[model samples]
Target chain A: MARVQLENVTKRYDDVTAVEDVSMEIEDGEFVTFVGPSGCGKSTTMETVAGLTKPTEGRVYIGDDDVTTLAPKDRGVAMVFQNIALFPHMDVYDNISFGLRLRTFSDDEIRKRVEQAAEIVQLEGMLDRMPDEMSGGQRQRVAIARAIVRNPDVFLMDEPLANLDAKLRVHMRTELQRLHRELETTIIYVTHDQAEAMTMSDRIAILDGGELQQIAPPLTCYNEPTNRFVAGFIGSPSMNFLEGELIEGGLRTENFDVELDPGAVPGVGVGDDVTLGVRPEDVHLAEHADSLADHTAHIEARTDVLEPMGDEVFVYLLLAEEVQGSMEEDPASSPNQLLMSVTPDTEIHEDQAVDVVLDRSKVHLFETATGDALVHGLTDRSDQESGPTATEAE
Target chain B: MSDRHRTDGGETRTDVLTESHEAELDRGPFQRWVDDSIKNPQKVYRAMFYVAAIFFLVTTLFPFYWLLMVALTPEGQLQDIIFTPNGFNPGAFVEVFQTIPFHWYVFNSFVIATASTIVVLIIGSLAGYAFGRLEFPGKVPLLLLVLVISFFPPAAFFIPLNDLFNTSFFFLEPITGDGTLYNTPGAMVLPLSAIFMPLAIFILTTFYSQIPEGLEDAARVEGTTRLGALFRVIIPLSAPGVATAGVLTFIAVYNEFFFSFLMTDGQPESWAPLLEGIIAYQGQYEVLYHLMAAASIIGVIPVAILVIVAQEKIVSGLTAGALKE
Candidate 1:
């Protein structure tokens, strides 16, 4: 196992910068996933790390060796492509043993290692089957087997589960986690699915527009995201953003008001426009006559749609006044929609108005113009006191 | 009770039968005839199919039939106009060997053609793989050069190549040292190889390019060098394409006339090309029709067998990657 580090690695394709100044360190035996939408350079970063594509600038290191100039085969890293990429002409056993044979191992040694890999992947019975004879999941297992037989320092997989059906993908996800634990090798996997990243990665690295957004442990990233993008991207039914102004005592909306802690905003005095973000699960619903004093913000919106998932219900809501404006404008471009996840026992009906409470502790505030998160002022002051002095920092 | 039941039962039964008969008549004789035709249309189709098959067979095989008939006829009976053969004899086959050094020419032609075919397959596949996969300086320009050479007429290069082969120029000696290639098979073989090399390279290159890039990447990750992957993975996968190139090259070399005719004129005694004697021996005094026909038939057998054996490979190689699974 090896620690892989990218030192300000950049890749440029003519005028387009496919990966721009990506720098991250993967610890030895750590499972780090690079997650992003399509064309976000996550795959490009993985390819750069695998030494398949040479960076236009900067360097890559595996352990203490600089591998930027080395050929891919000499880099001592194994990559499983999204398509599995098994040699169609070779059987499963031969495919697994290919790298060992290339290294000029003895026939007996090659056979032993290949069988060990096959047993690990549970593919012993399929040793003589061609890739076409195998199902999608089996083909993926062969790909994993191929990588495992090499016993490389690092394993790089690019969206390896994207081609499988949903049920098979879940099964393989757990199997991969088990494999990672058993092998304890450094694995750098790339996927666009956030759920997969959240479930499988020890630490998740999010990327967008060729820039690294955040890299942290899964729960840390979920609870305390670095910015609006992270906060919105990490959660399912994504966090809802409501436009409001920071008034004298609380955030103000058209029909409702939110009370913020006095020390929440330090730099700004009043009348600062900020976008408030609250996750779907964090929003609590109450009956119209109930007292919502402890809750910071309260809004009454008519339920537009109800999706009954097994554990929770997703209630899509819209303000009555906002609905009138949306109807006047284009019916499709409305922005007043909100999705709230409530307990399965809660009763909600379409077109019925209900009071929703936003929890202040879980809410995130961002600047309207820059989209930068506004951390609570009390925590920032405490952190500043404990932080390094200028000369010591330098 | 029996009298009452008999009163209207017979009349009702007759009325129902009459109604069914009237409905069948209304459907018309044409409809009935169409139904019968649909049930047994294969008979008419089979008859027409047989007739077409017979026409195609006669058209295709008549030339070969005439060639065999001429080959078996006596030289003295060449002028006979009757369709029926007076007698059969193998005198022409023996006479063909007696008049010329036929065995020597056969040996020369076989050596030249087989050697050229092997050379083309090896060099062509290597060049094709390089052109298809490798990234080096002037690659695109070199590819364009190959395409240009493939389209250029072989006759255009004859004079320059002849001069190069016949005489010492610049720093190098003539190709065969003291003896020029003017009356040797090398003159024909070398030039013909150069002419067909581009075709071999083009076909194999196109086939190699259709293989997925992921397979090569997998090979690279498996610790195989680029060249090793090419030999062990890419070449084996492209067997059909290589076979196609070999077959086409063999056919072209086997049938080449102008180069063999021009180069081996002075030494007709050494010319073993299958069709060479047919033209060379067609003089005013002795036409030698029987011997020419027999030689032509013998020459066609190897090529026909090769084409039949390699037909499947050719089709698959040409159609690879054109359709999705």
Candidate 2:
């Protein structure tokens, strides 16, 4: 196993920059996933490490050797392409044993390694089947077996599971993790699906617009995102934001007010524009205000739409009566609307008036001008005055 | 009403078959056939297909049949226009051999055609792969130039080429010590290969490009060099196209007469191709149409055999680009 490192690797195509000066070090045997939206340079960065594409500016090292100019085979890295590019003319045995045969391995050794790999992929008794005769899932397993048969220092997979059906994709996610656990080889996986990155990687590197935004454990990225982009990208049904200006004791927007202790948030003064961020689950109803240790005062809202998921219901709350028409025009894109989640059985209906409160400890603050995080949680001395742990707001 | 009283399942099965058979009998024979044909349009289509196929087969094969009939007719009745030969003269088939050195002509044709086909396949596949796969400066323009060269008439280059072969190569002496390459197999092989190259290149290119580039990438990552990938993956996968090119070049060169007749002294000893040998029957006094037809039929045998053997490859190679994975 070898640790793959990219030092300021950048790739430019004439005028467009595919991957800009990005650098990261992955530990040996670590499963690191590069996650981003499409065309965000995540795959480009992985290609650089695999020696498939040479970086314009920086060096790539695998196990202390600068392999920036090395060929893919010489770099000791095997890649499983997104299309599962198995040779259609070859049978399973020949496809899996291609690299070994190219290296002139003995017949006995090639057979032994091929069988071991096929067993790992649960592909026993399929050595004679052509690729065209297999299902997509089985074909991808053959591709994976082909990669693992080489026993390279690092395995590069570029959206290897993207071509499978949704149900098979989930199953293969578990299979890949199990494979990683067994082989203990350094895997650098590239994917545009955030959930895949979250569930499989030891460290998930989140990128946006050809730049690295954050690289940390999945939960760390979900809980304490470094910027507004990461905070908005990590969680599904993304976090909500309210653009407000700083007041003396709290923040104020046209629809509502939030009280906060200035000392808890750094680099902020009066009249500084900021965006208050909170997840859908963190917005609580006023009736359950007693459950929270600290919360903002009750804000009047009217339920606009109710989406009933199996386990929970998402309630789109209109914060101001006057802005209802504009938000209803395109509810999903509106910033004036607050989305709150409650139990599926909750007594809620569309167009019903409701009162909601924000859990202060779960709120996040970011610089509205720069889209950078200011603080993750808010604190107000007035709410702490009720009790040390819990408060029932009036 | 009592017919509704069914017994066991076996009785019902026999009743259903009897009912269908009775219905068939009720309908007139032609009507039943018509109904069945209407229900399955494929039956009508198959019938029409056979009729048209037989018509075309007769129209196309009539000339060859006439040639065989003429070959069997004796020279005494050669003036008569008869569909059937009145005299069964099998001796004319033997007479074609005794008259001229036809075996030497067949040998020359085989040598030149085979050599030209090998040269075309080797160069055509390499050029096709480069044009089909690689990214290089001037690739588009160069491919267009190759296509544009094929538009020029082969006759246009005959004068310049003949002069160069006979006299000198631009400012240097000819490769041959006597300053002429006439009557040699290389003379025909070189020109035939050059003339037949474009079609082979185009055929191989279409087929080669249709192959997914991912296969080559996979091969490359598995430790094969670029050329190795070409030999191991691309060429093997394009066997149909390569065979098609080889067969086409061989047949065209085998029947070639213009340069073969012009470059040689019309002698089998001078390496004249089969078409020239057939022309050699037209002597100064009288033309032997009987022996000429026999020689023509003999010359077509090899090509006809080749076509029958590789017919599937030829069809598939031509239409390879029309398919998708």
Candidate 3:
């Protein structure tokens, strides 16, 4: 296994820049995922690393060797496609050994390797079965087997589990983690799902509009995002934000004013425009907030909608009456209108009036003009809870 | 077309979704096709569909029915009774063979059509794959050129093709007769393949383009070049399309008459496709209806057999992309 590094990699298609100045390092034996929305150039970056698409600028390295202009086959990487790209005409045996046969390996050697790969994917007794005859999950395994048989220095998988059913997707996620542990190969997976990235990768590189937003451990990006985009993108149901102007003691909005730690967000005085962000889990009921954290804001809110998600309920609270004036009005500007996540045991109902507080230690402050975060949270901030470890989650 | 191609490829895939559910795929064709979504199809709609289908089928098959009836009926009964079971005469079939070298014409047609079909398939699939997958400059224009070629009427090029074959009366002065294709199988085979190449390319290109692009990318990552990926993955998966192209090209080349008539000296002693042989029944003033009908029936046998053999492939090929996306 070799470390894969892309230095200032940029790819352009005529006038459109698909990927711009993307530089990242994937440590050997590390499972790093590239997570982004569509057209964010995450896949283009991976394609550049795979040598499938030539980078308009920059260099690619595997281990200590520069392989910038190498063909995909020569780059020592195997890719599992977004769609399990198994040859429908070929049986599992032929599909797995395609690369081996292409390299002109001996029949005995090919057979031995194919068997070994089939064992790795647990595809025994399936060698003679055509792709059409297999299930979606089995087809995916065959696709994986095709990649692993090559035993390349790096494995590139482009949303490989996206096509599987939800339950199967989760099952395969754990299987992939197990495979990564067993094989100890450098794997760079690209996906649009934040859950997959947080659960599977040692680190995740978040991209947007063809540019890298933040690249760090999943927990680090979750706890402390570099910019507004990262803060908004990294969490489920997304981190809620309330736009307001900075006042003498705190952030001032149309309705309630949230108390802020002045020292926490430095270089910002009264009348300065700012955005306040708090995670759903951080917005607790006033009584619960008092017990959990010290120094919080008390806001009178009407529960608009409550979504029960098994263990916890997502409660959408409207802090300002005018904010719900019309659906056409800017929804983002609805002051103090926050989505709070509470345990299922917590008594909450729709249209119920309740006093909720934003946990003082969990508030993130960003400059309104620039979407850059000036303050991540209160003190001794550790956001590891949001990013569950691979094993703990599975 | 690309938007249609963009549908989730996995949706069309019948690969195992679950053990018990997909196991049903191995049970029987009728059961598999009658999946839960379509198990209780609307009766009214199904009936209407069958009615429309039968109507079209009858309209398409009427000509062949008429040809068979005319060929089987005795020439003496042509004006009165169209068909009579016991009165059916096999004499015209033998008379047609005696009237013109029918077997030799059949043999000639097979040779020329087979040659043209083979050439079209090779050139068509190659060019089709290139146009479908490769990103080269002027690719759109080149594809448009192929489409334009397919649209050109055979009659529009008849005179020009005759001049090229040196068969026009003006070229028969014997001093400037340089066209080598005249009075040869090459004359018919070459033009037939050229005209059919566009259609073959169109069919093959569309089929190739429908395969998930990732398959080729996977091949490249799996240590094969683009060319290798095409031969090893794409082409093999497009069997239906190849069969479709082959059958269509064979039929088109087999039925071609204008170019064959213009290029070949139709004495049956000279090279002639079956169509040219059929025309021999029409002398200067009178038309041999019985002989022509018999010849027509004989000419249709090979094509009919080909269609029957490859009917499944043709149907699948035509409808594969229809439901997608």
Candidate 4:
């Protein structure tokens, strides 16, 4: 296994930039996932690493070699495609042993490695089965087995589980983690699914619009996003963003006022525009305000819709009538809508007026003009004095 | 129903409605058939499908059956409307050999068709892969130009090609030592391969493109070069298309008559094809219909076997990309 590094790698397709000046060094034997939305350059970056697509401008190094111009076979990287691209004409044994056969390995050696890989993937006794005869999950196992049989320096997976059903996707996610541990091979995975990134990767390289936004461990990214895009993109039922302007003592949104010292936040002055960001789970009802170490004053809201998700309920609350009026055009991103998460047993209903408070430590402030995180926590902790509690700013 | 009608004072009204409903049910046979289709359509569909299939099968195979009947008829007893052979005297098959060097004609056709088909397949598959998978400028226009080659009839190139074959250009030599390709297998094989290459290219291109691109990428990563991927993964996955192209090219080249007649001396020793030799059955005065039918049947046996063996491949190839997995 070897560390894979991209130094200022930029790939362009005629007029459209697929990836731009993106650089990251993945430690040897670490699983690094490049996560982003569709057309967000995550897959392009991984392709550059795998030598499938040559970057327009920069060097890609694997171990000590600058493999930017190397052929894929020469780069010592094996890829598992999103479609689980097994040779449909070949049975499992042949598929798994394709690389070995290509290199003209001895028949006995090929068979032994094929069997070993099949066993690792739990595909024993399926050596004679054609790809068409196998289920999606089984085919995926065969694809992984195909990659593992080669024992390449790095395994490049481009959304290998995207085509599987949801249940199987989850199962394969755990299986991939187990495989990574057993093999201790460097794996560079690309996916748009946040859950997969959070669960599988040692670190996630979050990208958007052909640019790298952040690359850090899963929890670190979740707890401390570097920018508004990372803060918004890293979570499911994504973080709630309320557009507002900084006032004398705090921030003033369309509907409510949050009292805080303006001097506490960096890169923002009084009367400057800023956005308040908080996750759905961090928004609690006024009754649970005492549980929080610090919290914003209760803001009046009317429950718009309540989704009961077995363990917790997602309640979409309308912050105020005027806020709704101002965001009528883009209702999906309406600043008036505040998503609050509570336990399933909590009594809640649609159109019910309630008071909710934001967890002070969980709240994040972003520059409204540039979509960059300004401050993570607004609470004054004089003793700790670490500047911003949640803004690690990696 | 009676109690409710009586309570509502609508017994006469219910009688009128039932009479109209009965009237609606008394549809014509055609209308009734259509009505029954909506309730359970599979029965009618099966019957119609079987009828159409039987009709098609009979019409398609009638000529071969008639040829067999003619070939089996006793000499001079080939009468019109004689469905069965007048008598099962299989001597016409043996006499076909005595009439002319028919075996040599068959051999000549077989060698020429087989060689030309192999040439076409090798070139066509390579061109097909390039056209189907590779990205390059002028790809669309180049493919269209290849297709345009098939639009010209063989007769359009006959005179110029025959002239070229008869003479050596500045750098190029004649195919034969006689300074001409006449009466040689190269005459037919070369022209036939060129003539049929376009169709093969089109067929193989369509099939090759139907293979998922990811398979090639996977092969590339697995240490196979682009051409290696073509042979190891792409061609095998596209077996149906390659088979279909090969079969079609072989059959067309085997059955070709115009160029075969023009380029050869119409004698088996000079590599004349089966079609010309079959026509030679007509002597100075009398036409040997029985011998001709016998030769025809023998000539068709190879093609028939090829089609029979690859019928499934041809069908699947034609419908390869019609539905996605």
lDDT string for model 1 (B143-224, tens) is: 8998898898888988898787776444333444456655666777788888899999998898777677778878887787
Sorted by DockQ (best first), the order is 4, 1, 3, 2
lDDT, residue A242, candidate 4? 85
TM-score per candidate, in order?
0.83, 0.86, 0.76, 0.86
Stretches of model 4 off by over 4 angstroms after superposition: A321-333, A344-354, A380-394, B1-62, B65-89, B169-180, B285-287, B312-324
- Looking at model 1, residue B290 earns an lDDT score of 81
- Scanning candidate 3 chain B in windows of ten residues, the lowest lDDT window is B316-325
Docking class of 3: acceptable
lDDT of 2 by residue, B1-325 (tens): 3356454667778877998998867678799889899899998999999999999999999999999988888775776655888588878778989998887898889999999999999999899999988878898899898889888898898998777567644433354545467777777888879999999999999878877876777787777877888888888778788888899999999988788878777788877888787888888988888889898898888889878878876665455422224
Off by over 4 Å in 3: A12-16, A51-74, A245-271, A284-310, A313-334, A342-361, A380-394, B1-105, B130-145, B155-179, B223-231, B266-270, B276-298, B315-325
Q: Model 2: how far is B270 from its true place, Å?
A: 4.6
Best candidate per DockQ, number?
4
Candidate 4 per-residue lDDT, tens place, B242-274, comes to 998899999999988799889987988888999
Q: How would you encode candidate 4's per-residue C-alpha lDDT over A1-394 as one tens digit per residue?
A: 9999889999999899999899889999999999999999998898888777889999999999999999889999999999888887678898999999888689999999999999999999999998878888999999999999999999999999999999999999999999999999999999999999999999999999999999999999998899989998999888888889987667898788776767778878989999989999999999989998888889999888788999999998888854443334332246778888999989889888999999888888889999898887766542244334224311
- Per-candidate iRMSD: 3.4, 3.3, 3.5, 3.1
lDDT for position B296 in model 2 = 87
lDDT for A43 in candidate 3 is 93
- Ordered from best to worst TM-score, the candidate numbers read 4, 2, 1, 3
Model 3 chain A weakest lDDT span, ten residues long: A381-390
